[model samples]
Target: MGDLGRQLAYWDGAGAAKTFTHPVEHEWLAGVSRAARVLDYGCGYGRVMASLADHGFTELAGVDLAPALVARGRALRPDLAFDVLTDPPAVPRPDGSYDLVLLFAVLTCVPSAAAQRELIAETARLLAPGGLLYVSDLLLQEDERNRARYAAYADAHGTPYGVFETSDGAVCRHHSIDELRSLLGGFELVRERRVEVATMNGHGAQGVQLLVRAR
Candidate 1:
């Protein structure tokens, strides 16, 4: 597994400049009640939470591992709640505390499979039974540039096939469809969609959006 300390350090520093571009599909969330308790896990700058609040979601909270990012989020959306996650893979909230959880672009930031699974397990713990988990993340790209980077980085760092280092020094990982589904095994897939989104560094990439119900 990649060192969590290094990852956190990168985000605490250079991550402040990153602009998350994952689009939160309002249609996918239309069925959810406005009163539903929503938690945006790994929410950098509270962009998704702000969008949800604009759409009438009354209960919303966001948390991120990077203190700087969480501080930026609080400044950007003072009306919504934002907190720095003091513990990794374990949210401070009680089990079943949320009716919905958003995991946007978070899996990519976490380069270790075990850490990603632990994060998902925590998401499940936070969600009430039958609650929804909305995830948006990068998929392994077939392009030569990406393939070469993935191969080189994996070879150099002894990480997984899709793991790579960003130009700005952050470690990130893309996921295979099977790998992602395996991580969400505790949930029943409700809907999925493929879309092109700009990377935090502003490169176009293939990404997947998923809505799953907690079992």
Candidate 2:
């Protein structure tokens, strides 16, 4: 297959699509109350959007790096709308353009930490005054095994995805939580938490870390 196949395999992997999503996380996000325009950056199969939509958050959008994945996402939800390169990606939205931008699990994908910073800056630019940005991803740690699954993925599709620094000749860059913080400077961090432990075979748990930048 290809990059899209790799992503789809991961998303549709056992227990991830069904058991990984946490309502408390969504409820916590909903606490922002004023959130109207939400951009699900790097949305894979639209699972989070589907959940948010189920909770009455209809003003939703999704963006992904892979066109094949986006195409598949459309097939998964024929009634919903999908967009290009994820929202606010290249030419980001106007300042305070959206009330909330969901960037969950997006930061860790890029090969370089610098790219992560650029992505974060764009995300910050898209936030409205009092708008919030939510992000979650695997944190780099001493244990190399933590990102084994991603490593495997990289080995399978590194060249096609255009990724660099593969642990085993694959595309991968695991960031620690502190590195994540460095990426989002404009927005004040209100809260943070680690959602999974690789030791627990919790890759499906998403290594969740939520940061909200208050307007």
Best by lDDT: 1
Best by TM-score: 1
How high is the lDDT of residue 122 in model 2?
73
Error of 2 at 145 (Å): 3.3
Q: Encode model 2's per-residue lDDT on 1-215: one tens digit a residue.
A: 13222343343342133322433376567575533888888776676788777777867888775566666778888666677563324534567677888865565455554556667777777777787788766655444554455555568755312233423232445665565666666678877877763311244333657767754
Judged by whole-model lDDT over C-alpha atoms, candidate 2 comes out at: 0.60
Once fitted onto the true fold, the runs of candidate 2 whose alpha carbons sit more than 4 angstroms away are 1-24, 86-88, 142-170, 197-206
Residue by residue across 67-128, what tens digits does model 1's lDDT show?
Answer: 99988988888899988877777788899999999999999988888788888988999999
Against the true structure, what is each candidate's TM-score?
0.97, 0.71
Give per-candidate clash totals: 0, 6
- Candidate 1 colliding pairs: none
- Candidate 1 positional error at 30, Å: 0.9
